[model samples]
Target: MMTPATIDPLHTPLCDLLGCEVPVLLAGMGGVARWELAAAVAEAGGYATLGMVREDPALIESEVTALRAATDRPFAVNLIPSATDPALLEAQIRCCLDLGIGAFSFFWDVMPEVIARVKQAGCLVLHQVGTRQAAAEAEQAGVDVLIVQGVEAGGHVHGREAGLDLAVGVHAVSRLPVVIAGGISTGDDLAAALRAGLDGVQCGTAFLATGESFAHDYHKTRVTAATGDDTVLTDVFVLNWPKGAAVRVIGNSVTDALDGRLFGHDPATLPRDAIAWDGDAPRLRFSTDSPLRTTTGDMEAMALFAGQGAGRINDIPPAGVRLRDMAEAARRILAQG
Candidate 1:
């Protein structure tokens, strides 16, 4: 275990608030960040979140129960109100509250009513934003932390700015601590964010490549081999998501088929070709669903979400080891300065 003295440089108020020794946060990637990954990260002293977007209450309850069984450390449940149905979202929140989840993470849009509901239940709220305007709105909505994402982020990018630039801008205006997300995969990235006066970082692609991630092995292998250039920010994978929302995914056969026509492709006009399967359910070619561990069929045709930082990741280690190494490396970098 990393002691406070070893990771002192990387520690921030965010750590104390989130009940973690390190300031790094594992991004709650849907289908990828399950109970196993979340538990591994939390046990490693970094705050973790279970990506429970658009999931059933029973599944949420099961994952939360398993997570609590694995670690007593604090963790958060991630949900997106903009993408989920109102009734299902309400049920998800109720289930989480019943499970006594201490924190919640929301993305995409600022839903004050949802935040207020969680806050009313005495849960801490963390919101990820893409723009300064969104950050301001989230702060006003009573979010405890702001995760400023840049266009370089994988799986549904919300901002047009770069990660560091957006974080700097959001940090200037918000009284709450800010974390940068997008192209943050290495220790240097984390150290640089801290040196820039940001609170911490929220990593998705880095953790998604870890052994504990529920992402399909094919997806993990592709991410490890890909460079920043291999990623394309396109709305090509728009099915099941709000229209106009874009995602950054590694180039695959599906992306190749629509090479020049990456953007503005209407979902209604697209063919409902089933290219993969999650158990018995057929996953459409352009659906927003990424290939999970249980998925089969043409996995390459599925959305393989990865940030520009994919090039820097070369191996799939245990989630706990990966996070611990990152914190220690960041500490060394900070100490040297």
Candidate 2:
């Protein structure tokens, strides 16, 4: 068991429940939140989550192994059930359970059976919800925690409400501990969330700009240079995901070209032109694939996911260092009150 250091003014029930010293959580950004970043956040006394959406079982096992090797601290593996095929989701969960992963974080839709299955195997479940209905359902499905994601969140957004309002609404109705997501990039954001009675804050665009993140350097640079106005929530990048799934990304050529026609488009009918590549696999235009460290070819045209918080992040520091700095800053702010 990793003993958490006493972090004054920042520690909350979430810290104790997740076995971390701080209430900050690294958002499980698919492709971005790999083993290295997750391990760094966990080692830095913040809860970490490895994004394993629609991944092969072998890859999941390898990433989990790498994380465990890096630190004994508890972490969760994030999975999106609504996006993943049922069979693949089952395989992913089984692989995680077999690897003895202690916790699981889910997003998009609530799958009661999946939650119950992981709970049966003695793993904690954290579900990110965008609406009060989803939060209530997740609580009823036995999730240990709720992540209320506001529409301001980057990548795939499930709710239309703002982060704080959604979190407060969920907290009022649900018995589960709640963490707020979306547009949370700074220490002030973290402090405000806690002060608003939310348990913690989960950050994506902030952490995506960190050194350990698997996002391409271009993506990190774009995020660091961007302002809140630079991000646009659109359904333009819809391939591989269900129709109507909107994602917030840095505005680029693709978004510019499809400005007037961002929604109600069918992914199946879209041209399969290879705008980028990850190894030998061709990434199609309008696909949900973002620029990862291994991605190449017209990187700017790819989905550059960032939240409004992208404006707040100015540097690409080490993941552990950035997380600690955020926690310390939040502590200082909280102490003033």
Candidate 3:
């Protein structure tokens, strides 16, 4: 239940458009975001996004059903146009539409074919970009919303500039509603972005430590313990996945073992599902990655992607609790201004 103290119910143009009380959205973190996490955020009045990095047609259909069963609030999902088979992607989109999902976000190219399809089904399309040029292109490509990513983000980041710079540059050229991503963690962060003229903010690392998040306990602790400078962007972990994709993560044994040897390596050489230890917990093979709710092991050495603002994290609370607090606080700050 929403209380006066926790739910601010502040309205914005984007909020009006999405029918949400808060002007924040959860980043569709690949392998990390799932039904429970998405449900909690949506229940808290923020947009919840399910990541599609581990998705297949069947999986997406089932997951969409699961998410809808949990919440009547609006929800969204991520799509990587180049990551999967074309036939499978089309099927997944059709399934989502049939199951009542009305929004889709793409990582690149503004996703035209999908934009046309989803629009026919009465869905909203959001496209993310790291540059002003791409923002213009996405707007021209007919994306309903523009999410500008900055370099401070964790995981597969694409921004060449910081949040303010990217948002400013993109906003200067495009009239689309802009959602700034990367390095956002607090009410003040969202407030600052809104004050600077961005419509909303999408966050990845901030939700990692939430109780509904699938990240391992170790992953959450490491994020809270980390400083802003502790994160580094590298393609060492990309291996067989997205070749040379730069992911931001805190350094540990696995990262240190690689030590600048980033490219031209076969990830198959690494132990496929190898079992290692972070202390007493059993960690899996250092090869590929996914954040399982049942996560255990030397998870710090695994692919625990996080942004520079991880330094701001200090607790693992429910998504609704954390998001409500952030929304209320941001509304207060924005009201002050």
Residue 264 alpha-carbon offset, candidate 1, angstroms: 0.7
TM-score of candidate 2 versus the correct structure, residues matched by position: 0.97
Lowest summed lDDT window (length 10), candidate 1: 3-12
TM-score of each: 0.97, 0.97, 0.88
User: Which model is ahead, 1 or 3, in terms of lDDT?
Assistant: 1
lDDT by residue (tens digit), candidate 1, 125-231: 99999999999999999999999999999998998899898899889987999999999998999999999999999999999999999999999999999999999
The CA lDDT at 231 in model 3 is 81
lDDT of candidate 1 vs native? 0.93
Off by over 4 Å in 2: 1-7
**Residue 84 of model 1, lDDT score:** 94
Q: What is the Å distance of residue 141 in model 3 from its true position?
A: 1.2
lDDT of 3 at 53: 60
Q: Rank the candidates by TM-score, best first.
A: 1, 2, 3
* Global lDDT of model 3: 0.78
For candidate 1, the clash count comes to: 0
Question: Candidate 3, residues 1-337: lDDT per residue as tens digits?
Answer: 8775664435568887777778889899876688888999999988888987647767787777788899988877888776556787777777777777778888855566767888788888888888787788788877888999999987777765887888977887787889999989999898898888888999889998898887777778888888778887776675436555567887777777776774455455655554554345454544446446665555556777889889898888898898988887887896675
Tell me the spans in candidate 1 whose CA falls farther than 4 Å from its real position: 1-7
Q: What's the CA error at residue 328 for candidate 3, in Å?
A: 2.2
Give me the overall lDDT of model 2. Answer: 0.91
lDDT of each: 0.93, 0.91, 0.78
